[model samples]
Target: MTPAARKCLDQLRTLLRPASVATAGGFRPPSDPVTSWFCRAVGQPGENLPQWNGRPMIPILQIRIDELPYVPEQLAHLALIVVFLDMEDLPFDKPHGEGWLIREYTSTNGLVPLPEATHDFKPFPIRWTRVEDDAPYWEGACALLNMRALDDDEEAEKAFYDDFQRYDQTKVGGYPTVVQSDVGVEDFVFQIGSEEKVHLAWVDAGIAYFFRAPDGTWRWACEFY
Candidate 1:
């Protein structure tokens, strides 16, 4: 690893807390560092940044970082990769029985509550975005790694288009079918923020983590699916 990568890795190690020892009954505390970090970050309420009127807006899912071991044999180096959440224009703040953005509500004829049950609408556009302050860290990390995103790769881009086409063809029904037209992955790395920081998300040993920007602090983690 380069000196820069080593320094980044060293900083990450400081955030990790040692796992609790196993008890006599074979009971062990949660030893997974990524899981521990994720629980704490998500458990606490994050600051909701300001929103704009015209351009698309995505919520910020605040994140932190943890230590990871290097394993070069498996091509498992800590490369920075960006992940994006697909966006859609869905109804929000509708009538009580109308159900929040549920396409299937047609059967109830816009009833606020379909007899026995009511559906709650969460805040619209349920994806996260990076804050303005953290873009430099992300950019620096990407420059250090020298990696390209799937969007920048010809094969990867073609695969995405082909898969999306197949997905569109496979749909059968009409009314409730989710035709997400004008829907696309918003790279918060560029829009509403600096282009330097690539919005990154990666899985290490099956645990999901994201680089929270301004500085690419790798504190947040979760299961991908």
Candidate 2:
């Protein structure tokens, strides 16, 4: 990691509690199947690469129970895992290439979730544009959720393609689905605040963590890191 990148990571670590590190437990689909496949087709593996410090570019952030407002008895002992990718590692300018693969695993059992259910999670897409808005290598990814309503595979594919096109044209992106890992969180939902931004519902904690840019500035909704 670059000095600046390392500094940013350190700051992030300070803001959040310690992560519950575990191997992603299930066979989830790529947050962006088309994009994931494209990147893999061009050589990026859908599987997590060890090069990224033994984790996917998208690190899993676990929400501590004590920090939560009201923890259900069933969930009080279970930590919530949020998956995110580093935009700096993506190849935004390159066409038909693979991006990072974001996966979810259980720290308790080291089990990967079922691919079908995990793929259903909502994607959080963000585009980083130059001041002139002429650059194209914008970045985005998804969060792991356990909702079932977002499991519509067909709709998810369509949305992803449409969003990918927009990213190619306007340099914008957003999550494509809503269903996430099957860790048993029922209140999970994708909250959209504006046309350009949205966030994954971390209902258990009542606080939605938005993706901030490298400058530590908030992008619009959907406009996350």
Candidate 3:
């Protein structure tokens, strides 16, 4: 067997499945005949995406809180949490809100669906699925984040970065799949990968990490290779 495949298997076998749940999201096919993913969606809009100046923000991620495989207590009361980015330029060098925003809704009742996107803004619908056994798959994650390292670091060092990886998909509730240094505190909420199917790209294949601040506000950072 290929060495990489064997290494992956070994990593998987050792990962502990904690009670945390993970969910994956991806784009829906264009011909599927529906614009709204009622439970949740990615690019497509529900209530209108807010705007700055005269330009509207681009909807990138949306979650129907109660619909999740295991609802987080913090979000259980909300109908959806939506993430929107600047339509043209994403702010990597500046503070989080300079280019993006997150909004939470308690109800969707009597809301009007947004008008069809123009040639300038194309909407991509999304679908969600519950995935099993997700967790921070490597001890390196803890060390990198300044958290306490694994018990057997001296022995585990031999396998560093070569054999194991955390579940690195566009997901909620697992250890973040980072490309460079990890960002934010341990109050990790979720990470959004570059959803190529939805025309979402962060610089070049970067993913944005979301965190919950002590005061209950949300914060974000991006990492790329």
Candidate whose TM-score is highest? 3
TM-score of each: 0.16, 0.21, 0.66
> What would the per-residue lDDT of candidate 1 be over residues 1-225, giving only the tens digit for each residue?
344434444443332221111011123323321121111112212322122233222322211111122111111222211121212322132221121110111121222211111122121111222111111122332333333454245554343334221111100111111122211111111111111122222122122222223333222223222
Best by lDDT: 3
Q: Write the per-residue lDDT of candidate 3 for residues 8-29, one digit (tens) a residue.
A: 4455445533223333334444
What is the clash tally of candidate 3?
0
Q: After superposition, how far is residue 78 of candidate 1 from its true place, in Å?
A: 16
In order, candidate lDDTs are 0.22, 0.27, 0.55
User: RMSD, each candidate, Å?
Assistant: 19.4, 21.3, 6.7
Query: What number of clashing residue pairs does each candidate have, in the order they appear?
Result: 15, 25, 0
The 10-residue segment of model 3 with minimum total lDDT is 32-41
Worst lDDT run of 10 residues, candidate 1, spans 168-177
By descending lDDT, how would the candidates be arranged? 3, 2, 1
RMSD of 2: 21.3
Per-residue lDDT of candidate 2, residues 85-191 (tens digit): 33344323322213322232223233322222122233332322222111111122212222233234545434333433211111111222222221111222222
